[model samples]
Target: MAVIIKHNELEYAAKESAISEFALLTGKKQSGAEKHMKYDIRMLEAGRFSFPYHFHRNSEELFVILSGCAVLRTPTEFFEVHEGDVIFFEMGPDGAHQLYNHTAEPCRYLDLRTVSGLDVCEYPDSGKINILPEQEVYQTGDQVDYYQGEAQVRDKWPESVLEKSR
Candidate 1:
């Protein structure tokens, strides 16, 4: 019953970034909408950072750029993708990937993802990890935090040792 008519659906804009054509107007009632799992379609404008770079442990994703151009970074390498191009990221075990619009013109794309039970995602840059509850990204911070060695005194052996080891 959750079907979106492409022609009837309005472009969704991103609230955080003005460079996007996705606002609240076209947002679906459900956060994750897809049969067999959660899926969403987003048409982004030019000069937008699609989303944060993260890896899904159990979910697979596909990015189809309909217009303009962007760059997709996988664990193994980076690729320059343009309109009519599609990128498939299999579930699990790849160096978490990211997509960005480095071009001056607007880039429109469709993002499709499927949920395979439970999953965890890692954000390499900010050192953040998200344990997805259903289809939501839960910011749980670093389960393991690293400490600086030189700043600690002698009694802080475990902490100091950990720092020194690094």
Candidate 2:
């Protein structure tokens, strides 16, 4: 079934940080979309950023500016974005981005992304990779060697098992 929702009908939550303040539309809760790609609206306050510079390993994202203006920062460049602008971000480091609204008024944009069972999000500025759903954050330098926690087995198989197989 197609879902129809008014902008005002969606609940909004405020996310505040030292460098940013924004309202995010709670689309999943309102529309009951679980498996499908998610869509939410972010209304960023003036002089605030939408999010940190980051990229997703398993999901793609797109943004549509509904109103106002902001500066979009990518891995190598910063560009001005305004109303009616459509932006697509592919999965991985090349797609890393952040948006800052420098205008006096609010900047509204639709945040859309593919649904993934698990996602690894890298925050370059913080040197952290966030494993979503499980919600674990680890610094890039914190990576441990594989099998670091596993108990070592001296032999490939037990003698009894090998005899039985023979």
Candidate 3:
């Protein structure tokens, strides 16, 4: 039987699972996650984040604003979205994005994601993918130079300082 989610039910469900669902996201943390179909909608409060700054190479994200507002933060910029707003984030370089609830009141929204196989995500600031068991993860930054093969390096900083003195 097909289940039709009513307006009230959706609101209740979002609030009930919002916190737990957000915390359930794991695996490297950078690549983000897929919310279970049961909790397809998410409601967040001020200072709450939907996901870390990451981009899925495969899946597309869709959002329908239900109440309050949120700031959709992208790699290069951000957009302030409010109720009645409908938006879709595609997959690719231009599609990478994350959203944040910045209003005093909780912002409720519908998040719909299409499964696009197993995808690797990248964090712009961290420059690392929470690589799944199948995907390769890499570190990116100006401070660290890339190397191939079994590279060896000696840190100039004292290794002794990192250990706890007994």
Say which candidate scores most in TM-score: 2
Range of the 10 consecutive residues with the lowest summed lDDT in candidate 3: 23-32
Superposed Cα deviation of residue 96, candidate 2 (Å): 0.2
The per-residue C-alpha lDDT of model 2 at residue 115 equals: 75
Q: What C-alpha lDDT values do all the predictions have?
A: 0.64, 0.82, 0.64
Clashing pairs in 2: none
Q: Global CA lDDT of candidate 3, please?
A: 0.64
Q: Which residue runs of candidate 3 sit more than 4 Å off their true CA positions?
A: 10-39, 132-166
Quote model 1's TM-score: 0.64
Runs in model 2 deviating more than 4 A are 8-10, 16-29, 154-166
lDDT of 3 by residue, 1-166 (tens): 3445555534333222345424212111121334432125566667777766777776777878887898888757998999999888777657777778777887777777776457767777567875543757777553343565335433544668646543
TM-score, one value per model: 0.64, 0.83, 0.61
**What is candidate 1's lDDT per residue for 53-159, written digit by digit as tens?**
77877778887777778788777788899889988787665747777767777666667777666677777666666677644544556243555454556565677
